[model samples]
Target: MSHPQAKIHRMSELVEPIATVTFSEVPNEAFLALGMRDYWDGYFAGRAAPLGQAPAEVVHAVFYNFADGEVARHIPWVWGKITPQEAIAVRERGTAAALRQLLGPLVGSPGLVRAADLATRAAVSAPTEGRALYAGLRTLDVPEDPVARLWHAATLLREHRGDGHNAALLAHGIGGTQAHVLMALSLGMKAEEFGRVHHLPRARLATVVDGLRGRGLVNADGGFTDAGREVKERIETLTDELAAPPYDVLSADELDELTAGLEPIAAAARGHDD
Candidate 1:
């Protein structure tokens, strides 16, 4: 049998793409409908809407990955263009439309309904302490539609795990830039590409890389050194452990059923994107 933590980890991997489709694939038109012109504007506003007009500093603290000042540039400003409730509505409608286009008949299948029910159970049962994003999301009403429910559940679980991940990073003494550097190195991504994605300047990226190299975490070739890999593994393992409590509400068989039900849906989402 898979380790219980491993099963929870698997659930996280399966749910990630579905949880993030709104950020990655949802059309600009969705945000445009609210008079938001920039993607990041919509992204910061929509995701943080659960927190009800949270300030930039609050967003930066919870988001945990953006470069310094990156969040401040959009937030508060985004709130001016759209209210938190409006942003939430746009995110839900857009995400639902996107899932329908991607999942087709799977959207209405009994399998989806079962998976949504199971995932929502686990999500709602998760502990909320110190998980600001997840706690914020949990306060919202659950969607009545299966597709929307599944998507919302995925988001809840995603943010729950993400908040735990931030804790793991903190426990390891890893700052946001340093964490991104470690991630890029682990994924074999070019520093330039990762830097562009996170809006880190080349010099700033190099500085963080150099700091890691000083700590013997990164090698000369920009990959994780032996110690670096171990640190990364430890962080991921702890993150999985922290994320496992929610799944405890499920019996072993129910966990299996939830994973099985989500597999095809996640695969369909992947295929659509690919």
Candidate 2:
């Protein structure tokens, strides 16, 4: 079981990618000039899935949950923005450039780097016997360029893990309101902000809160009760279990080497956000 405390260590690397990799370092002026679809096309180009061909709703439903109905509305517009091949090329160039800039001497370790990339990609490229999201993403064509393949591979794996988490959440009967409410502290999101973004109605949340309170799972403020904390920990541990198969593709030593090589790049990427 993944200890709840264990999750805290991993989140620093995961939380920002949806924003940074998508648009954080990107200049607002560029998006204004290019338009939304072009911006997204550039941002999301390489993946195991042709999200470009996917309806916005499909992409939104899979990615950003459609609960509040806010972010996914732009999907159709996003899908038609560019050819999959063009988008893949654009994505690969960007990854190669970033690797050169951030990795420095580590660029010499291309085989090791590629192995690291493949380890994570295994989640998607391998048969999705049980993964709902991985199976869906695997339908898209893999990129031919090595770097783009790496980028796409990592992303699909990341998202596959995310989807697995959602499934775990559902299996636990933790509704969206309770899940986000519980995650506010865990995810570093303010409760009010999370509620707003998810479009969770206060009244609905109140009812859920009441249920949790009755179960001794939460307090009046929706803070975790001891039982609540235990439940949350279990859910997180299960999520990690569901997401673990991909990393198993690498031996312990190989995985460590990959993490070491990627750490500088990941840190640099985080620096861009900071």
Candidate 3:
């Protein structure tokens, strides 16, 4: 059997790729470009502290409206100290105004202008299967930023793998059954034990268990096959290596504040089976 990790490890050893600037990169620019100009200044204005000090600040500052800031402050610190709903309303109004300003000339008629603006926004923001596949490719930790290699691996896996029900589960933020089974076996779970943890019926789970054995993604007797173990270890190593470096200049107090808000998100991600 072809070793999956050999390819993944080669890919992982490459550099991080230049993904399109996600909303997480520049909150103000992204929001404004998305026609949320009112939220444009709101990001920087919302707080004296590092905005991430608040839970969901990343989501709100970039993806949603900043009108949810609870503690009110000045122009530079213009935080919205209100409910999420209020913040959303403020964001909507700001976005509408910005779109009107940008598109007003082309859309001479006001009614048509509004419809055209909404249509444009929808087209820009709509998600697609290809985009999801692209996002998945972007998430892989390639060693030397070899995005093409990672894309190749994903392509290979998709073409050769079992039915995508398990893969879809992984994409949906649920752990992949196959991945979970591999993990359980890595942890030395017997077939019965693995079945129990997954709540799979003996017959169905055994089919997965046997499938893993055949693909060399798991092992007989429910232990990690050599290939399986290597893949899991390399993935863990790559995850740590690929994570953004901690800020060097952060004060102890500042670090604590940042961690407090981010800890939960990290924990939830780590706890994911896939």
Candidate 4:
């Protein structure tokens, strides 16, 4: 059997698509209805809403992955268009719509209800210390609707793990741009592809790559050196350990049920994306 931490990690991965479909896959109209300019604006506003009118620098610090100036472009500006509470409402509604479209009849099924219950229990049990995003999200009430409740639970767990991941990256002394480069290498993504996604200019990306090479974390060919691979593994392991405590509230059988219930839902969401 997998360690409880490993099982929790697997379940979190399965829940990600449900938790984040509104970020990219949801229609632009959902955001536009909130008086936002575009999806990027909605992205920044919705994700940061829990932080309650946070400035770009704060978002940059907590989000810990976007390129410099990326957060600034959308934040404060997005706040001008819509308040944080309103943005949260739109995000929740959009997520429910997307999940319904993907999940169909499974939205209210017993399996989904059981999974939501287990996930919510774990999320509520998670520690808030050192987890800024999750801590803020915990302030909001869980939605009453079943599909919305499931999405809410998944979002809580997602942010909990994300907060832990950022802490691990910080401990390893990785900066935002550098973290992207390492992630690309770890996931076998092209530098150009990942760089573009993060709004990293070619020159800036080259500088980050050169710095990683200086630290013996990257090779001349832009792949991970032995040290780089070791660092990445260590970071991931630490993140998983940090994320484990929440699921400690669940027993072995409950963890298995959560995974089983979410697997098909994740598959359906992935299938829709494909």
The local distance difference test score of model 4 is 0.85
Give me the runs in candidate 1 sitting further than 4 Å from their true place: 1-3, 195-199
lDDT of 3 by residue, 31-62 (tens): 45443335434443322122233444443422
| Candidate 2 wrong stretches, greater than 4 Å | 1-20, 27-33, 37-52, 80-125, 130-132, 140-147, 187-190, 193-216
- lDDT, candidate 4, 141-217, per-residue tens: 99988888888888998899999999999999998778878889898875667744445567878888899999999
* Candidate 1 local lDDT, 144-207, one digit each (tens): 9999999999999999999999999999989888888778777888555675345666788888
Ordering by TM-score: 1, 4, 2, 3
TM match of model 1 to true structure: 0.95
Question: TM-score, each model?
Answer: 0.95, 0.70, 0.30, 0.95
- Sliding window of 10 residues with minimal summed lDDT for model 3: 14-23
Error of 4 at 160 (Å): 0.4
lDDT of 1 at 255: 93
User: Which candidate comes out best when scored by lDDT?
Assistant: 1
- Each model's Cα RMSD: 1.8, 4.9, 20.3, 1.8
- CA-lDDT, candidates in order: 0.87, 0.55, 0.36, 0.85
Error of 4 at 121 (Å): 0.8
